[model samples]
Target: MISAEPFVSGKYLIDGNWVDAKDKTTVINPANINEVVGHVALCSEQDVQNAIESSERAYHSWKRTPLEERAECMRAAAEELKKIIEENVSLYVRENGKVLVEAKKDLLRCVDIMLQGADEIFEWSKAESLQGPQKVIVRKRPRGVAAIIMPWNSPLILTFKRVVPAILTGNTVVVKPATNCPLALMAFLHVVESHFPPGVINVVTGSGAMIGDVLCTDPRVRTVAFVGSTETGKDIIRKSASTVKKIYMELGGNDPAIILDDAILDEKAITRLRMGILKAAGQVCSAIKRIYVHESRYEEVVGKLTKEFQHIYVGNGIQPDSMMGPLNNKNQFDYVTGLIQHAKDSGANVKTVGIKLDPDTWDQGYFMLPSIVTGVNQQSEIVRAEQFGPVIPILPFKTIEEVVEMANDTEYGLRASVWTENEDLAILLADQLDAGAVFHNNHTIFQDLHLDFPGAKESGLSRETRHCGMEYFSDSYGFAN
Candidate 1:
């Protein structure tokens, strides 16, 4: 099912053209490291400088482009994206090392975000009339250039989330895709870039350390949008402070899934819970990292979940029946395995499930079976940290107050979920939880795209999606007569 052209794109897409860089980096499929995916050009400092210069020059004109014209461009880009998305699904799975189903969802989300932006941006673009003593009129204007620094887990969707809002609001953007899975996203970007002005959307690949800070510290870039670890986000914040630019970040999340006493353990609920834990092999920023089950139902929850996880098929991404793929890179694979080893050494009872499709070659890949760990304290390394792997710790608690305390005792407060048949209890616990978005019943990739996703506490700063985040791309100026 592999094709030759799924990952062919310009090295540095600046000024609507592909310029090759001197250094090249090879990309390997994490599922089978022996199988090389492709090679990407590692951009230098000069290449980054050229991109910012091009983006700044385009910003002056792009910001001036009429609203109707910009709207039409977005619509056209959305349509083009729709036609090519399905074709690129296979490429995404191979490049990103996620299952086929997850890869499809990632690509489709890109089209959905683009289409939604094309329509909703117009709704808020209108100037408002204020009935004040001075009769002031308020209008939101573009903030020149925006820098989009993205992560690899769901590169296309995460990149588009920032790219759509930034460009549709009349601001030019420079995108830095994660070094791990940059090619698949760039293929689609190539199509969208052809429709826009020469330098309206530029992309630079390779190491973020070499050229990441320039985008944040540059005076021309008025806003920085990023998705990654808390440590990296903090670094970006420090760099962005130099220019005092606005920043939109979605950082690390130690998401908690609380199982209330009245929690429904039907097949559907169990499936949804497993999804929350295993989606993208639990590499998602908002995945259920730690689960707190009521004491009365702890045994049943573990038993049911163990059976569910056992049936899961772990294999290469290209396999149609693969439910989960390997970790995206060696660094992550090593980090996750290390956490599991530490837990095991600390006397934690670890239960592993899932069948490797090819057991003989499993050692050659960065694959790990799904695991459930118990007998760990709240301060245990696995319990306190974000595993970002297939391993999840299931803890039992007697009191709601105690469970709430345990769940909130982490630096990450991105998202959490409450699973229960009682709606009142779910709402009450949701209010008490320290997460930004609380889900009832299900916590999958399926979410209302219109809702505002605010990053609470250490998880992130500001908000993402919906009206609040869309507004971050521009500034509102009031004119008084």
Candidate 2:
């Protein structure tokens, strides 16, 4: 067990004060036998009311501040955020069960998104010349008190994606990070509160069902930003609509990757595909859950992937050799395990990769071997639903048209990637793929801060990034960078 010193001295930055929650929720290190790393304060309804009122009071003057001044505040906060890089990664790995290297990557990615928001402000401020002297200065101003409800999957990046733009756009915010992964976002808000004024960025961590409802329905919040599953996003949309508030959502994704026969089954391509499906234990919404491979190369690709999966080193994240760690929490672990069992019982070909390690040691923690499923028919449950685990369910297709149709058959259209060495074939397949973002030669992890990332159908409503993120703080028509 790792020794615990107070990593973050303060908690709950409410109206600029480092206080505690009325009730606290204990955060466990899942990889370490439910060890208590720290406690997150669960805000009461009264706490939510206070935060909203504080943001509302500050918005009066904050919204009037010049865009340059707002950008300066965001930059200062970003600098503070950068300072906590090492400390934040430590907390993330301990509490969230991600490998140390992956946690560091997340922290760095968060910084990039923050800087991107600052750099893109100039483009958002461009004024257009009208036909007459009545120059239409289409200024993109802050929406108001933005209530940001971020999920546990990617807390740091999600913070920068929403909080940075909301702050740069001149909107005061109250962040309610997913209780399971509040540590990193809490550290981030601490940096903001240190440099920015009170109420500019307040964080209240708590239960989503209880505290989230208060934040979403409160009249003081002009806009609500969320990143989570589809069911919860839909609920927030319904609640926010009653208040006539702007709702920005980034929900679930059942992404697919189509491998054409022209694709080379080289060592590099096979290794990349394995990493894409298994990263973060495949807990990500954009993780490649389905793969439609051309019939000719189907066996060859599966052979390569199975061999790669067999080599994964699963253990505690603190161990340097441990490439894969336990799932973030027990709920997620149980969910993934249940899904695997369901697939097995439903007659899908399930294969467990890597040695079983020690089942005796595994009983104390939530650990499962990375899974792969093949030979499942198109109408199987595994193909239709989002497993959200480190299991890739692959199907063989004879033609490009049939494969594209198979990829688009799902209720989701979040992301899809087509792998091929032939440029023309790759482009043709990418264009026909029905996803918000399509990759020609790689998996769906090809996300940059500048890209407009969102989902389609039951996935998500509005986009998030660059102007899309800035627009989260404004009316749908008002453009903001």
Candidate 3:
């Protein structure tokens, strides 16, 4: 059993103070459900209100603070966060069931995000002048208090992605982390809150069902930023409609990867495919779920992928040699398992690829081997739904037009990639695919901070990163002299 003394704080960061909740909830390690990793507060409705009020009160003054000063605080917070990177990574491994390497990447990404937001403060807050107008000047102003709800899949990076930009643009924020994995993120926020003045940044932990509506529908909240399932995003939209507040949502994704006839089937290509499907155990929003390969290269590509999958090691994340870990919770494990079983019942060929490192502990935790399915119908549940687990389906297409139609048939258009040696064909296919972000000769897992990342159709409604990211937390006003 894991020791809880180091991980448990049993408190929430509100108005720059670590406040205790009336009740507490135990957090279990996903790799060993019997092991208690830590405990967090189950915040009450009154606690939510207190956080909102604190943020609202701070917004008035925070908005007027100089941009340079705000950036300085963010840099200081980043340095402070750097000091705890190793500890946070270990906590992340236990709390979220990600292997040590993946957990470390998540923590470092948070630092990068915080520093990047600091660097962009000046560019985002600069005033623009128009020559054609009558001395018109356009300046960006902070939206009042913001409510940021983060997901459990990648808590730290996603939380700071919104928090850093929101605070850097002078908007005070109240963060609500996913209930299943809140300890690591809440602890990190504790470090961050110390760098800022009281009430500038706050955290509330509890059941989202209990306090989500309260956070989004609150009259004082001017912006609601969220990253989760599509259904939840829709609910948030309806709840915020009464106040008509600005909402930025990064919802579900059923990303596709098209393998053209001329695509290389080498080690690099196989590794990209492997990482895209198995990274974070396939819980990422942009994970490659559907693959369309040219009929001629289908057999060869499958052979390569199967070999790559056979080499993955699955066990507890803290184990040095383990490559993948368990699902974040029982519900997610059950959901993904149901999808896999459904595909099997529909007459699809299912193959379990990876080796389980610890057979005795397999039943003790939410563990499943990486599954690869072939001969799956294009319209099957496995292909159409976001499994969000370590299950991927490979299908063959006769022609380019047929594959393009199959790829664009889904309602989700969050991200997609095309792999081909022909640059001209890659670009053409990318343009034709219905996704927010498309890549040529690569997978969709790679990201660039300076690019505009947004979703199309039901995938998402707003953009994040670069200018769009900062603007999402602010409003623009035009002044004439």
**lDDT scores for all predictions?**
0.86, 0.78, 0.87
Clashing pairs for model 1 are none
**Candidate 1 residue runs with Cα over 4 Å from true position:** 5-10, 130-134
Measured against the true structure, the TM-scores of the candidates, in listed sequence, are 0.97, 0.94, 0.97
TM-score-wise, the better of 1 and 2 is 1
Q: In each prediction, how many residue pairs overlap at the backbone (N, C-alpha, C within less than 3 A)? A: 0, 0, 0
Off by over 4 Å in 3: 1-3, 6-8
Ranking by TM-score: 3, 1, 2
**lDDT by residue for model 3 over 352-443, one digit each (tens)?**
98889898888988988998899887889999999999999999999999999999999899889999999998889878998988887666
lDDT at 14 for candidate 2? 74
The local distance difference test score of model 3 is 0.87
Q: Give a tens-digit lDDT track for model 2, residues 1-481.
A: 4556354422677788878555786887777765877878877788878888888887888877787777777677777777778866777888777888998998888777777788887787665444554544455566789998888877887777788888777789988888887876677767766777778878777778877789888888888888888899888888887789888877888899888888877888887788778778787888888888989988988888999999988877766777887788778888878877888998888999875444556766667778889879788887787877778888999987789888888888888888888888877877887677877767745466777668878777776455637776764332333
Q: Among these predicted structures, which one has the highest lDDT?
A: 3
TM-score, candidate number 3: 0.97
